[model samples]
Target chain A: MTGTLFLQTLVDGLILGGIFSLSAVGFSLIFGVLGVVNLSHGIFVLLGAYLGLALKEAWGIDPLMAIPLVFGALFVLGGLVQITLVSGAVRRGSLMSSLLITFGVSLMLRDLIILVFGPDVQSLSSSWLFDTFRIGGVIVDGARASGLIASLLSLGLLSYVLYRSKVGRAMRATAQQDFAAGLCGIDVKKIYAMTFGVSAGFAGVSGIIVGLINPFTPFDDTHWTLNAFVTVVLGGVGSPVGALLGGLMLGGISTFSSQYVGSLYPNVFIFGALLLMLIVRPNGLLGNAYKGSV
Target chain B: MNKQISRRTALGLLGATMTSATALRAMPARAATDGVIRFGGSLGMSGRYAETGLNIRHGYETAIKYINEEKGGVQIAGKTYSLELGIVDDASDPARATTLIQRQVDEGVDFFLGSYGSNVVLPCAGITEAAGKVTVQVGGSADQIFTQGYENIFGFFPRASRAWVTSIEFFKSIEPKPKTVSVMATNSAFSKLNAQAAAAGCKEIGLEVLDVLELPEQVTDSSSALATLRARTPDILITTTVDQNSLVIARQMIATETNVPLLYQFLGPQLPAYRESLGAKADGVVMQLPWDESLEFTDPTFGDTQSYIDYYNATNDRPFSYHTVGASSCITTYIEAMKAAGSVDPLAVRDALDAIDIVTAFGPVNFTEDGDGDPILMGAKIGQVQGGEIKVVYPENLRTAETLYPTPTWAEKG
Candidate 1:
């Protein structure tokens, strides 16, 4: 029975890790290539959830089915924000300017969410996503399973785009030397904007997964943003594989700490683990995926 | 005819004067401050508590509207003055709430309306107490708020877990009596006190206490905790958290197939989203409400519980909730105390409140001199979701339907 509980804990951690990896991958990518520390990353995630909710409520579109629509919507939105707000800060060349502007942008977006969504807790769901299955002595539910599958696929897509696609090489080149990439006839600013858009698109997709598992409100953005930063630091900066490792490790630490030590003790453990990892590997386990970026 | 005017004639003028917008707030009395009773507070107008805080404001507004527009405001020392509610959005931040309350105190506001959540209430209540002004709080019910010996902070909510203890008596009365209970709670101050009190209640009632697991603040997953509860297979599962957190716990429970005979929640089931979230699976889940339609407490302002509900239904901007009732009761309590004290002086009103014991639209209010947790006014009657509607099912006389005792298994609910 104890072994089963431990195994169930492990399984839950893995599911949660998939979600965390998906959520942070966008933040990691932006942090890797753009080096902007996009604080509004969580807003993009929440925007996705709200859009998914709108689609589901209006037309009975399942959250999974609403993903492409949400992704498209947020990609455009994220690009505009980068071009207008973040790009200004980036051009200013002040170290803290981008962070400050993004933070400001995040606050405005949060208010915008409240204005539209009416400041109430809302959720997205589907009748088909309500299944519970037991394999051996472990239990896994449909919402989380679906979330995991969605997250992995999204992460896989992101990985393929970053490592295999021509646009991927351009992004890496821009991350290495913006001046050199511009001289190579690559539009550095455009690459940065696309990376930001892709990052936002992934964040939105994760929001759909998150909404599947739990209810959310406009105020919940802070939690997602902080968790993404921690995941990036723990796993390795700016890589999908690092995000997965960090997310999975964070999930394991969270669930096991909750089960064994105490439920409220996970934050303490999470921070302690983060501090230890920072000491051991300043750039994270796999190290900065794009080392020359920052 | 009164005040040299017929009541119907006065109402006609008022009806014509009232604009189409009933989203009216900061209601300034048409009859100016012959004797003004100033009320103000910082509310969670823009964060997680934005909706709830605004509902509380509507509750205050509803009472003030009925009193000023209908009853011609408060009659104090042979002079009548209308109630004015001045509020600022604190965004549910504790430090901001504290600062906003102190600012109101500096501005010489007479009375304070409490913020919605425990986090905000704890800090702001101290500032009000220090200013020697009385704050009638609605939502924050952590027992320490009262036990800390602040005479100025009056709470509508009793001890955080008073209902949990009371519900035990109801639970024990059911046949096929439950012998074991498991508790899950968030780590919020209110929920911590709540879960502890509930565990104690189960034990005192001779039920075997399984585990009382605490979920983290902003918990993303509770699989291990739910799995533990499922393993123990307690007959009853009591979850303590705000409505949002409750959704997460319930979704996980359903997803994991953690079947407890009875699923009892502190906050979620009263909400429509609870039913919408769980669909048919919400059936048989139980909680208690501080105010309900069946309550017959006569209110001086709204006339009775039903009348207040009528006013709330007619004019409130937010959805129907016990919170609206509690917020109205905050205003009603102030008005009654003012009438008793017969003066607009803050100290006089404070003394009146300390000595007053009256049943408002919400329920009975009898504050112990120490102002520590009082169960008499906690007044949360047990309710269960039956046929997709929440119905009272405890304390025999208040039972709208029989208890879904030994609630059906998850598959059985399906």
Candidate 2:
């Protein structure tokens, strides 16, 4: 490939990685805090997009402007679901039950969205953001650039919360050892609910970005959920930084394979890489080796 | 004396009631011969293919409504029988389609109207063929469906392989005559065949095939694909995928500013929803379709092409797509076959379908030995989105507008 083409592909891959990283971090947070895989995480993203679309169409609010509303709404919804349905599974400490319950929740949410939206593809349009600009012989999409910036800001804020806040310390302590943290005066159940809320807020932000970048349908969740799972596993299962690295790696591999090898074989390359990663380092690049949490 | 007579009478009455219940259980078998011609099929009403499935359902319903109200039903074997359509939502799952087809067969539906997508139709075809039922379909055009040697399934549209022939032919007719082409399609069987056909046809017409890409079905982004194409920079770009995939590709093309002289998408660009989604970006994109509202044709059931359009617009939320027209044609073709055979029997209708030749609101309907519609009679026509309207630009006689050669670049348009 020529230098310009290679650069263009790299730019595209990184843009895709930014979105994937946001989604993976959300998924990773839930798993890290609750020790329960949130299979419905992708649906939270889709639901957020739909809400953004609704806000845009009904109230003339731009998708970017409506992001905060989407995030808050999803956070509340996620918190309610955790309190009402998921707490029982977590209390019982049955991982399979948690997986199955969340899977069921995902299915129900997908069906509900389909009922409301009628399975037609919906897109978020920003006239100015959809244009393209050239940067040193490489084409860059305005929407993707904005999405990348938004992803970084969200990730930075999440890191600040995790590392610099009192609640963040309590959440970490509970994740490490709920019993010990409870004895130390942390409200473990409340921390779980808060973690789920924050995790879903991340998904909400990612969803708006995704909708701005691509047209989405109700069925898009499963595809994204699978990609997030792959990203989490490839990165350290419960590590946000690892998820970011894994997302970038996957995006680069998908883009390069589609460009050089064949578009048809990108999935093959992705899964193959996943297999190799699992075999070589099951705990992932940054995962806790002894914990084997994932 | 009254009490003694009641004991024997009660025993006789109980035996008579038991006999009546047994007779009532056998009533459904007789209902099949009750002079009502029932058509049954499954539609993808709830999943990825739901929009297209809804269009097909509306088309079939419109045609059936026209037949019953305007044409006064079909006269078979010296008696007039009204048409009844029994539809079930398969939720776009092939397994559900098979199960629904078997249920319809058991319920004694006289024939089947095929559902949308080749994946669903192929499995439904197998079930219908095994049950000795005849199915008239417009959704599936995969070559595999024809090669199965099943005489029961009849297609109303041209094969998937020839779906893009008219678009290629239109390109050849342009003044500059585009020479290089890049083709991409979703990796599904139907889409793959569509892309392969476009590539092969372009080669046959002396255009250099720059690239042929098969993207995964679940791909939500196309930036990398567009970036790859930017290096090659073909004169023409062709996409053979569903509406959503096509829309994504089109938007990404605009975002990346990858401009070509001509762009043709197999199915998406023809629909009103697609145009609405992309707005101005939808302009200058050419499409190939079997039928459009502009076509001038008269049908016995629905007065004429214009009338059909009026009816569809009046009833449905969106304008009639090619899928709607193709689906309506399937029902009309079956009605014509029944008229020719003078019977509602599945075997007789299947034979008559092979023998009958007629034109409907969509186009001419003639099934070849392989049970596929003859491309010569029902070939695809090229349409281009110009000034926010889809206009027929090819086939000379049916041309509503002249072909706009060398579509303007995104920057130029802006």
Model 2 residue B37 lDDT? 76
Regions of candidate 1 where Cα sits further than 4 Å from its true position: A287-294, B1-33, B161-163, B372-374
The DockQ-based CAPRI class assigned to model 2 is medium
Model 1 lDDT tens row, A151-222 = 888888887887899999899888788889999999989998998899899999999999988888898898
Interface RMSD of the candidates, in order: 1.1, 1.3
Estimated TM-score per prediction?
A: 0.93, 0.92
For candidate 1, the docking band is medium
Residue-level error in angstroms, candidate 2, position B262: 0.6
* lDDT of candidate model 2 versus the reference: 0.83
Query: What is the lDDT, from 0 to 100, of the residue B395 in candidate 2?
Result: 86
